[model samples]
Target: MYVSVKGGEAAIDNAHRLLADRRRGDRSVPALTLDQIAEQLVLGVDRVMSEGSLYDRRLAALAIKQARGDLIEAIFLVRAYRTTLPRFGFAEPVDTGAMLVERRISACYKDLPGGQLLGPTFDYTHRLLDEALDGDPEVEPGETREGATEPVSRIADILGGEGLIEEEISGNDEPDDINQTPLEFPLSRAMRLQSLARGDEGFLLALGYSTQRGYARSHPFAGEIRIGEVEVEVFMPELGFAVPVGRVQLTECQMVNQFKGSAKVPPQFTRGYGLVFGQSERKAMAMALCDRALRAGELGEDIVAPAQDQEFVISHCDNVQATGFVEHLKLPHHVDFQAELGLVRTMRTQFEQAESAMENKEAAE
Candidate 1:
């Protein structure tokens, strides 16, 4: 039995109004500006952009404000807005090798080429909260060093030269776009990377942590993590060359994991790659771990954990989709509940009538 109940128009309107009022809060304090959100809440904006799969910092900040500092809601808003935008032709893949390096570090080698540079990171800081941040505090200017004349050599390349690491295969084949095509099983590495790049930070972090805790241990080492700005260029058909469009900050991680070779090949370190739209080192690192874990099959290792399952991770990694399916239960299901309630009552009544008839028969006998 299905029934539709109407007459909540006014209620819905008022509820929306109430929500707006709550979002505004007490009007005595000055309202937050988009610039303040974009500049001060940089990490939040970065997360929104990374998860939303959009790079516009300003738009991300606006979504953050509209969502009342709820990052997930902001991500949802940005993704919704992204669908309406016009698609210009895809840009040529940005070259990370030529990136203007800001922060470069390696855990495997302490004295690698281009030396470790720790640019604005919380790695060395104490976790204690400082009350001084509550008020405006003057910040000392950061020390500047002479810029490198040439691109820094990647650690993977150094290892590759000695045959200590697996070689990265390059192909001219056009990678499948997840946006255009529905995801199918046994996804290409390119498609998997696309899905993982936009996956929820917390979810990836958990999966990555699981790998570290021996659920699907890879004996991973952070070969290198570099954060910098890379120039984006689009090919001009009329001009016969690519022109620089803009530069976007990015974080890239290369994880080296142990691989025992089979009959055909010798043991060599395997590599997992992670890249994101902003200076999101944590997300990048986590993505790298999960990426390596998902390669269990290719590496001839057993897939004994959730992180090793491609379908499980790819299907559930999307926070927006997960939230939508979970939250939809809050919507009215009164008709279905009512049908269940009626069925239970009818069964109870029938049982009571049968009991009464049995009692009467016993008494007459």
Candidate 2:
């Protein structure tokens, strides 16, 4: 148990006040509005929402503003606020195949049914920083085409139809919610996906990178990455029908990994799925890699890498928990440190006495 340090209340209060003052820094400059943050720093807002497990863009912007641009702190604030809200009902599984495509690409196929739409991507851009961005300049409108009249076919579906890739089986069982129950080992694929969806982007990215470097390599290919708005629906008990609530922007990635079949099974492409809120392509791709890496046991692959360890990945992937444990070390540990210091001093004295006694005996002899 930890005891709070008394007599530091005034100091703590002052520190909080100072933090507020710093957050507001230089009143002469115009303060940033929530609209600017939500619209301009969209990626940051998306990250906070994804990790916080909350889907409020406005609230996420507010958290980013309050946390002074610290995405982790913004996520923590959003999560804390989320816990206070009551759940009305769960939404039905989103149909990504019908997503209003803003951007869609596949590394596996050069020309698919829905020709590649490179919408607002930095893939072809030179890495050099543009000096024009430092000044307010009129931005040129991008070329537009008529929106697709019908839903585009998913690449995974095409692959599955040809019997080239494993088909995803839909089940009647409701997936477990991590928020409602504690995570136990030997987690279901649904539970693992849930944990990874909200896992730290940096942590997942590193793990994903490690896999590419031959640590539990799963000869992966980005089968498809589509980003757009998907209609969300909730089943209404009163109406006996599902009603569309709203559309949420999502980035969905399907990674095709190589799998050598066993005696019973035939050689076919395996899949790693990632679906995240907003346009988080990097996060979605990273999630897919980690998701595939964690499937070692079920796939009958040797679990020799850290990424393959479900317990380690699931336990340490949460940035909130990791941050709390690491940051807590800054708190006072006076009693604990005092005991260690005393013990060390006693050992030093005993060692010195023993050394002196040996020298005297050697001289006398």
Candidate 3:
């Protein structure tokens, strides 16, 4: 095999130009606008924002257009672009508790303090193609659903009061972000959650389902899942307070799990948590289960399987990293493979000769 030359850069450039030409279609045809993509393919934009680790729908749409609808590539574009942008400040974590919530429901409660609001969902709608969208018809959504004044408290609050489950966020202290720095060996709650948020939806879904299939089956009820905009504020030491820096759309899920009798802990309910960048309740729910399953060791439960091991799950979670490395094997590896093949042949020949000599010696004896 010929030793490869490093013409990858030139090839990549040409490929990029080809992609641009294809995405644009005929030069005579109009190019699709970011707004159009954002409006028409909103679910794509949502997935990009959700998995891309970005909160901006417009930016996700732009990335999707630029990547020619390759979602993973679009996610990479968003992540790369986001790094260069200067941080203005952090926003106050919108008290989703005090949120002007859009959707809120509980499997754990009959009725919650903050009434359930099924704001905007296609949950019950049959997934039939509306031929109406075929024609160039312009339409607008109607007025917002009038919501309740009160915000909902978690159903786990009932269990928490009765001391059935361990508490969640420690109100007194804030956790550091894994993105702010590289993670060391052991991880904190913030770091673990951060890794899972950026992981692939399908991967998380599989891991979560494995638990139900007895891989680490811990029964969990969807305690509450909500999707909406939350106000974020960064603490300003100068002002000695956190100010509103921005708003981010988010999906959050908190699961109430049945924790049966273990060695140290009694039979009680526990919690699994997930918070992501956009309104993806499915991802959030799956993430919460996986998160709890990964916490098996710390929770003093059985760490019998890969899914139960925190290091195994979190280390393999990031799709961008995983996909890139896995695909790299597709690149030219002739030199490496040839060397390994030569070593194998040499070893086989030596083994055959040695066995022949041993057999002949025995015959001579």
Candidate 4:
């Protein structure tokens, strides 16, 4: 068994070496640089950064490359590296309202105040692959048009003016950090959002989809989905001022769900918000739906599905924990297997002896 373990360790080392060779491919072809990955595979890098809860684009790109483009693995790498870094003081909350709007669209209005600026979206593009991209691609400047430089108005704000939506409270309560503290249910709104932000994208996507398929049945509309860069500020204790730390690309989704009035309250449009660290629209949207569904109790809606269950959703959402447990099946469990084997064998022997005794008694009779 020790020999087998030693052999397995050696095999693992060799496998890593082989993987590194494969990741680099041939010497003749130039290796892909981190900058190239950061620029070209921006979406993937964004996902890794968002899930990893870190915003370093270069690190995200490096993780992606090291993981051989496996996004979940890349996320794991970034997250593991993040734990070793020293924690400086927390950054001040960003004001998304003041974001430099790149792509802002509202499903609620035909034309918003600034009009719809469809910036760099694949919404209308054909799904066919351009063969020109297979070879060395040329960097060319595309046509740029001047549009709304004015700050885009939010659809939720318009609804709020008419008292059609629930009132938003600007409370000064500090948000709980689940990363620092262990999780206990039922989670607070802040903790819920934090958990979802770092939760597995695919898991959230599936749960969000289940709601759409009549599981929880929150009639949702994408009120607004905005993608842009927001300036991050950190509060300096000594300076007594919040200074601009950096800028990060963000995808924010606000979903509006139709809700009927309860016995004591008037009907209004409810909201679910999703904000991620990078250009992740689908993830943002999925997160929004799941967020709303999780708030079914707060909204006075009946909780009828797994998505609505707080414990079910939050507990199984983390990919790292899930993957670790699932992959542990690959490890040696000979002792465990032997225990089960012995129990089964003992039971079988007892059954056989009892059957033989019964047969002898019948013959004598």
Indicate which candidate wins on lDDT.
2
231-298 per-residue lDDT for model 2 (tens digits): 99999999999999999999999999998888977999999989899989999999999999999999
TM-score of 3: 0.86
Task: Provide TM-scores for the models.
Answer: 0.92, 0.96, 0.86, 0.93
* Model 3 stretches with alpha carbons more than 4 Å out: 1-3, 6-10, 26-29, 87-89, 138-143, 148-150, 169-174, 261-266, 347-365
Q: Give stretches of model 4 more than 4 Å off.
A: 1-9, 145-149, 350-365
Clashes of each: 0, 0, 7, 0
Q: Give the TM-score of candidate 2.
A: 0.96
| Clashing residue pairs, backbone N/CA/C < 3 A, model 1 | none
How many residue pairs of model 4 clash at the backbone?
Answer: 0
Tens-place lDDT per residue, model 1, 253-331, is 9999998889987999998889998889999999999999999988888999999999999999999998899998988
Model 2, global lDDT: 0.92
Tens-digit lDDT string for candidate 3 (1-365):
54475667898899889877888888786788999998888777888887888788899999999988998889889988888889876555567765556778777777767667776678878899999988688888756656544465666777788988877656656677777878775787778888889888888888898888888858888988887777787888998988777777778899988878577768888889998876788889999998888778777776887667777788887778888899999888889999999999999999999999999999999
Which 10 residues in a row give candidate 3 its minimum summed lDDT?
142-151
Return the TM-score for candidate 1, rounded to 2 decimals.
0.92
Q: How far in Å is the alpha carbon of 352 misplaced in model 2?
A: 3.2
Per-residue lDDT of 251 in model 3: 81
CA lDDT of each prediction against the hidden true structure = 0.91, 0.92, 0.81, 0.89
